[model samples]
Target: MTSDRMTPEVLWSMGRIGTFNVSPDGNTAVYTVTYYSVEQNKSHSVIYVLNLNSKAQTLLTTSPKSEYSPVFIKNGQKIAYLTAESGTSQLWEMNVDGTDKRQISFEKDDISEFLFSPDEKLLILIKEVETDASIAKNDSDLPKASGMVINNLMYKHWDTYVKSIPHPFVARFNGDRIEDSTDILEGEPYECPMMPFGGIEQLSWSPDSKSIAYTCRKKTGKAYAISTDSDIFLYDIATKSVKNLCKQADWTEQPCDTTMSLEHQAVNHQQKDNNVGYDQNPAFSPDGQRIAWLSMERDGYESDRTRLCVYEFATGNKTYVTEKFESGVDQFLWMPNSKNLCFSGVWHGKTQIYTTNLKGDVKPLTDEVADFSLVSLAPNGKDIFCKKHSMKQADEVYLLKGNKLEQITFENKHIYDRLTMGNVEERWVATTDGKKELCWVIYPPHFDATKKYPALLFCEGGPQSPVSQFWSYRWNFQIMAANDYIIIAPNRRGLPGFGMEWLEQISGDYSGQCMQDYLSAIDDLKKEPYVDEEHLGAVGASFGGYSVYWLAGNHDKRFKAFIAHDGIYNTQQQYVETEEMWFPNWDLKSAPWIKNAEGQMQKAFRESPHLYVDKWDTPILCIHGQRDFRIEYTQAESAFSAARLRGIPAQLLLFPDENHWVLKPQNGILWQRTFFRWLDRWLKPDNK
Candidate 1:
């Protein structure tokens, strides 16, 4: 019999739920459930329609191919979705009750994402078009030549080499067929939806359906790689003209006074509302009089505060709504009344829903300890639906009607029922810097204070990502606890949900106070008699991975084992190898050779993990994906090699086909098994 505790196999067996769309009448919702098959080593998504009133659900599609992005169309009488039954993804429509299914689009290229206009007479579809001539044209000339002639800076991004770019096409739909399609970007080399994670979220149609607001950086090559200055563009469908909605007053037409230093020139440029940083995910109000989007103030700081900015189309006036929120907005939706908007922002240690009006008054709507994200509002606008998840449970749809929240979906109820979850307790410990830090302590299932349990220090990546009540498949706190180990995840000096000062402290100070914050959390927890202080371990990926490597040399015999995944081993090597130059330049404060005002480079490179391998005494497991261009796999290999050379008992788990994340099912399982196997060896000596 399988253990009643949650395991890697049980974790993978559970179904995952995605975001959903509500019908126009708000009485029903359509969502997708994704299930992974270990035997097939793949995952498939199936769409389902649920009556919001009666809590009745009906599976809509059963085709072998996955059907997703279901939306109610034709006045809630029909449902439209995308499927790949014809070998290439295309638009398909069906009756609301799951009947009269038929293909509606026959475009040559695959339709990655689509959105119908408010009137349902127009449609916008996202398709990958070959824009880079040198990459695609030359490839056809030499079909077998594997060599790529690189001439641009953004030639490669994330995991794949840049070739085809996704563009939005506006076409007229006459119920059965789409006609007179026009590429909004036309022949421009820029991507409308952006790359990697962006999709339909980057584009929003006006209520009048006469114009489309899209997010695009409009830069290529080196310019694109060094900046995060994407702007929101308003494209008029009838006039075939585009205008930059976030453009400042004559900043582009007026040349900057270049006599000053580059630093001084940037400061001068900041005087205007140039919207220098990322301005994306435009959402037009239901009335079509105003448009709002998530905007970041800094040019290269991707982790900058994402303020909600609203722009009035008539007056061309912009208001920074939610300025009082302090923290950043994750997602927002305009209320049906158009006077108020609901948004989700992080505060303390949880993401909660808040409402803000045009006058900038913010009010908390829900204050649950768990994170709540805005999904869709009811037709009445008073009732809202959100996706809520905690450290112990995965995502599930919840309906918020005033003070009452009802669970609308139970995608993994079966798995959850059979297993017992550990207790997640939030504790605030005093940091070495004379500040209080929040750390979540998760005990093993049926934990007893009489017995000693091994503990793990969970360092977070993004260096700026939140250590909130997040439910992640890879870094799940519950799974670690299920293995009879205590987990201490800290919202260190660099993590969000604390405040801006805390979040920005990690930048240019990777091995500084944030490191102390991690130590403080573990040190405080290890003092507990129930914790096995001698067998502590540190594990993280990306920036967190960098933390593990740094801690290994400087942990002072505090930890017995270390696991670093796709972490930065050498600061000098990472500066040149990484695709995005802005990330390292901002975080490290300068290039490897150049010295900043504070001489951060000297201190940053001086403390690189590769430099302090002499102090490593603990066993380590380094896992990395070869395709992780953000932080190359070579970082992990170098760490692993240095450990083995020092005879510190190291293991390297490399995936050539994977990226920064172990996405494949089989690889994920292997990762979990190897992770526990290594931990059990050093941390649980008795088990070995």
Candidate 2:
């Protein structure tokens, strides 16, 4: 291996730029840059303002507390960002040249997210408040509860217990200080912006700044267990009134009754089995006369197609603008004219920008290749800026002009100039069932066609998510290629961007057709003379991890080694322990205890990787995080136990502070080192 190649240290040292906000004049842009310190094992972010006219950038905030979410306010003279310099994340104001920094909010609770009103006189902030304030009251004489009391279905979320829920608050900002604050959803049990990954996108202010629209769940209790019903609510700031825009007649506001009778037959059974939908990401048009948001058609199905919808303020009418659009919409914004919208969505394994009108007319603005996101449109809607990245390059700001993309930022140019990255090529392979799948291969740097190299097949997690041209921090193909290894990533049958039918094929059959597709991909790769057939390895995370586990038992002879990260070994137990019940319920088609044909206790059990553990013979490496509530830590324990019991060579890597993904700077370095070492032990023994 060469010392001048791209390594984990070099990758971590590169700055990560995100959240762009163009000034009103379009002469400048403000964005956040996050830099990590591997030695300190911490990250610090600061805001930077780039002068489009001079092509010069200036640091806007030098706060050590980590500033982010930079936005131009006060007619582009001053900038506002969030910082924890005051012990909690609060709104802070500073000059455009990184001067006159002042704290604006003095709240006891930490602000999750905030947005300035169009008029700049009010600040709408989202804060998480305890359900019972008394529980959080610090009584020095009183002892804290040793154990958590569970009483609700949502007692826990992704990685934490649900002790408090996020709510919105309206504050009157007088440029220097907050005059007063009012809780918008004070008495409601709903959480604005929903949970998990929701952010500022869920809240929107009207053009006049008189009303605000946000998304929240209307159903509680067991309804939440199998329901994905989230509705947009309009709150009038003047009258302090709220209305559920998506609520239907006869909708009861009462809490669910869970009491059962002695006979277990006379219990409260009035709960309706309704298949409502999810509506979120509300954005008001420039004219403020209409509101646009993304909506899902069916309830309880998270993978349902997302359609763009618009609501007219004057007519009180709603319309679906993307009903005919085949792909799901990820993020979008209204044009300045308020007649059209620009959005980014996945198409053929790539995310491209597109334009759509209220009449449902959709047109692609970019090609169906290379990953593009974090779109920012100028005030005139003529200039568009987005972050673009590919297999060979990291994300850099690019300006979309006409049909050509102009790179505006070269943050990683210095790092790229000194390193020799692999050559990436896209290929289409035919599966065993005669279906063509998209696969990407990366050849080692300074490669020769006559020489064979060890290959590592990387499976994506989503099972439904496509492994596009996006640059990944975790499963970096460049680093693998730098280690003198060929990397192969296949977009199999169950992945997205290939149409709805193909994506839903893996549902209720995780180990069936998808496994065959993977096997077919590997067989196709072996046909190439540059691939070493004798030293093949497989690696994946999440669903991909599940696939690796399944392959370890059912087809171990094909690969020399395997790596599974946060994978499900026991499908039956996964269904019962996962926090998100709807995913398992929909994927498996029923509860774990439900019986199927031949008196089998759960149809998904047939696809369980644990069932075929007796046939396992391959050496494997298992990686899991204790904070991964989605898959739970027990899955890793069970996998490692099975491998050790079978007397097969296996190793376990556990992260106590990390989540599903290895995010921290130091942890990421450790993860990469461990991963490459495991692969080297079996696949690259000669190098060792």
Candidate 3:
């Protein structure tokens, strides 16, 4: 029976709330509500509109359609989004009142992601294709016209084994029906050496709708699972003419090694050529007088310190808006007046929103509000929407500086206050072997000084990811804590938010010193009150999955259980077979991507938990998504097979159709339900 003492609401809420969009007046915002039901073993998200002025809400469409990426078109009167109907996500639009909804495109393609131009005249949706032929590894043919494969050397540098989603074209919508779905880009092999079509991206449109800027990913070799180089291009719909913008700037961002991620892009070119500049996140001033884009590479490397440049169309002069070393601004938006740039930045471990003038002089808008950053600027420009999340609470959209974070909605408000943080405090910990490494730790929740409870260490995805954090009482650590488990989640090396230096710490060394750091967090937490060293457990997914394999095998007695989800067991295989074939490709450049290579063997073994499998005796639960493009299914299969051979009592759970991150509501509930069942069996909560 479900325990009355259980506060699973926190877990349900964590699975629910996420950023959707802001209203026109900025006084209101929209977000999604995701909930996981243990009984049904499912998780679902429904769109919600928040009134910051009154802390009220209105639910939008609610069904298994998985309506997502809700963007405001003309305030909230219309929302352009992608939803599932016939098993494939397609572009759809609906009015504010939730009426007049219709599917926008009939293209026989799976709509993965999309964005609406500010003017609302155009909508760009990312499309993926399926075929009878096995997905290929080499670049030979460009996906031209229809049904052709997209080729260009630019794909060579990316995570090899990308999904076969090619030949993305931009379609102009007249009302809901598309008027033009044209191939605005093509390969100019003579100079660019690329077939222009591969990954469909959100093409940036000028505020005046005169021009669109995009990057044609090109450049290959030395890495996979990531792009090597891409050059931005300009398209003028009126003249039907296209030009390569980077051809004049010729920027080259070299691969040193670091983990800074927003989206898993096909390619991001670093500006190296003095004449050529590389930029991302193009924005035209509201008046459409000037264009502003990021100069992504600073001093031969992708610096957190990037440059913001504005080009005056009338004079053709480029102005470096910010004289300071800066760029890669998050949630950036231009003021309606077009005079100031509003963006969020990380300063001393805090993510805060700041405003900068056209010249780039900056000042913080929200202060001492940890992890508070601008979410959206209302279409009408009357209010600004932001989310404030702290160590103690799951993130919530708040009305800034007006009435103390007008808690936009009431959904999960109580969970934060109801949560028992215990003596578990947050601390930044670092360890080193070759370079300075950074990690974050949350001491056991409700940690008592006298009693000893089982300790669980979580090894999260290392690249382009932060160890999962939720302000709710339902985070894994918190949930485990509710069961008298002392939990420790480490940021570990090669994590984002930290500078490039820290993120690149694990470059050629995936599991070496950093693995020890995770173990160390366990050892350190073990010494604390209410922690049991003998009952230690570890869990992770993706790269963390590799860590689980590494840990389970090397020191079988160290953990009671190791939950490895979609982990990488065979490095050599992943580099070749995984659909998002970038992981294995990139790590090989740091060292030989071989099984028993001498110089790198020690470090490789440390990173690869599967290498120590012969000695593994710990009980482990392995989970995987059947359709995962990132880590691939073989990762789970090999590890589970190895465990069975070794008689380690390893359990396996596979979800068909689920990707790297389970998106379906039911799957999400099933994941947590199954996860907790395994936990209860292995690390049974004392609370029960």
Candidate 4:
């Protein structure tokens, strides 16, 4: 085989090239380069600048420290990025030539998202301030007797939990000086509504640099903080006053119990549109006269109807464009001239980019794009800069001109090196929602076409996520394939590439339909020759964790075993007790789930696998970190107790200092080893 056929050392590398920012002249582009070493089973990132004019690339930073999200600032001579080294993440800005590297933020410790302003005058970074609410008077500091007998769900789902740690405000990227800056909107450790995390996301400075507009989440609650709704917020620099641009819905009066919504499934789903709240991605019109954004007429988790509202700042006049257009709009950009706008949204399940004028004249701009990212038209409106990920590759940046598509990066050129072409097959199946789901089938190291083998199904949990089709070191289709298991992974519904309906559909009913969808995907796999249904098992984390529980209860007889890393089993209780009040706040309708516990309990109880422990007999594995602030350890504890009460097979594993997503390297390897061991014991072809 030619060297070209062999994946390049540089090509077969890390995570992804993200945070693409074009230079002012559009000749130089800087993007993030990431890769995860499987042997190391760790993630590393760096910044690279690619020059279109010279066809040259410059890689920055020295070894040991990973830099990400590089962008040209201060007239394109310097770039600002977030760097993680020495166990701390802080702001750093350096010259284009990689000299004069200086640390900007002086936080003793932090993880932040930062950007240089359009004018390059100030640097803005989102800092997560960890406050120890250890409660000096807590029952004890010597670790309580947490030895709850393991249950089937914990063993089957591989469930885990962590103490609630503070989450930084969402979408709260402020325009502040990185060196010595005042926070625009920061999460107060003890705030009730955890709306800050995404409050300032999708932000763009007004052309005049006078103010900023962003989407903010505010939940009216007395219990920990939850965002009953998200709305548009306008912050004026001069007056330093933050104005709530929309009316606040009386969520309190109605009660926020997840179960008791009077609205029908469809009605509850469309709740984002009611006057109470509506909107995301607030972008200022190029001319600064108007702002265009997405607003849900109905604001439920799965509701699909959203409008493009053009707000005239001066006159306070609002005009709704694309009225009742339900296909979800994922991303939008102001056509350089601001006369026309280009946005990427879903239509019939596939993500397609559309261009429209202020009058609402819309046209399907691209026909062949199955998935799209970075949907901005070139300054001339002649082309759009986007990364199009096909079944063949994860994502690639493409320049869509008048009649042709130009590939901008060759990042994935040798992604499939060393793998036989015939062994890598792409499969498509229908998800629970009737949308077409895509999956990649990788045969074992020496796969025989006619042979059947045990298969492993891996699911990733996120509102708009896929099972990670791209190459990875720790876990990917290829990694699983090497482990002697046919990886029958599916990119199920509710992923961004599919569009808004599928993405939003799984919102409120996270454990509801999405869980069923996982079951459907496995059922579909059973029909394939290469898959062995009788020897099937599944693994997922976070949202995927919730699904494992949902599936374990509803479809335990289907799998030999299960693993749910950081899964939530008891939603009714989890809805209130979790640390980051915001998750429960946003997921649940209001707060004090106990208020409607009678009905909410019935809803969660009906859905919770823990409530129906009698149905679970499958071996399960549960994992959690005592320090996790996202979903508390009690969730898994509550789940484990129920599993054992019913005398189901279960095992519980606890990490004293880990969080939502395992970060400690030593523990990650341990978790993965234990998880796969449990899988091998149950799903191993030889074991049987």
TM-score of each: 0.97, 0.94, 0.75, 0.74
Ranking, TM-score, top scorer first: 1, 2, 3, 4
TM-score of 2: 0.94
> What digit string (tens of lDDT, one per residue) describes model 2 on residues 612-682?
88889989999999999889878988999999999999999999998889989989999999999999999
Write model 1 residue lDDT over 560-584, tens digit each, in one string: 9999988998888998889877787
Better of 2 and 4 by TM-score: 2
Model 3, C-alpha of 348: deviation from truth (Å): 5.7
Ranking 2 against 3 by lDDT, winner = 2
Query: Highest TM-score, which number?
Result: 1
In model 3, what is the error at residue 484, expressed in angstroms? 2.1
Clashing pairs in 1: none
Model 1 TM-score on a 0 to 1 scale? 0.97
The Cα RMSD of model 3 versus the native structure comes to: 6.7
Tens-digit lDDT string for candidate 4 (460-504): 765445553344423445445555677666666666545555665
lDDT of 4 at 328: 56
How does model 4 score by TM-score? Answer: 0.74
Top lDDT: which candidate number?
1
lDDT of 2: 0.82
Query: Model 4, 639: alpha-carbon shift in Å?
Result: 5.1
